[model samples]
Target: MVGIVVVSHSRKAAEGIRDVATEMGGDARVEAVGGTGDGRIGTSPEPISRAIADAADGNGVVVLVDLGSAVMNAEIAIEEAELEEEVVLADAPVMEGALNAAVAAGAPDATVDSVRMAAEDAQRVKKFG
Candidate 1:
């Protein structure tokens, strides 16, 4: 199964999103990472890297980030982790993308590209439609 990492500016938000994703992910590895080391409302690469490493199960990881610095920090985290497993940042909304990716990750045939594509597909979801 593909692993997942949810990155947000608020630790609470990341944990909440991870909770939701986990409900649909079954036993899939989903890690939440947010806020600075000092509990400030910001993103940090260290914790994100740790989360990425923790989430991986010899499979690739799919990262869904919230806004602004989360993206940059996630990128840096991926580089810092220096894992042999592949990691890709999905160009999708943090909440919806995590849900979608989680479901896709649970699939038996799930792969990094497939999970990332599933996350990116969330951009087409209609909430009020």
Candidate 2:
């Protein structure tokens, strides 16, 4: 099964999103990482790297970011982790993409590309008519 990481500026938000995603993921490995070491509202590469490594299970990891520095930090974390597992950041909405990726990752046939694609597909989701 593919793993997932949800990144946000606020620790609460990241954990909240992970909670929601996990409810729909069903045993899928989803990690929530955000804020600085001191619990400030900011992104940190160290914790993000740790989350990436934690989420990895020799399958792959799909990261979902809230915005801006989150992406940069995720990139930095990816580089610093030096993981052998294929890790890719999904360019999708944080909440929606996390949900989609979580569900896809729970599938037995799920792959990194498939999970990432599912997350990116959230970009096309319609909320209201």
Best by TM-score: 2
Per-model lDDT: 0.94, 0.94
Clashing pairs in 1: none
Q: For residues 65-113, what per-residue lDDT tens digits would candidate 1 score against the true structure?
A: 9999999999998888889999999999999999999999989899999
CA displacement after TM-score superposition, residue 123 of candidate 2 (Å): 0.6
- Per-residue lDDT, model 1, residue 91, is 98
Each candidate: RMSD: 0.8, 0.7
Deviation (Å) of 24 in candidate 2: 1.2
Candidate with maximal lDDT: 2
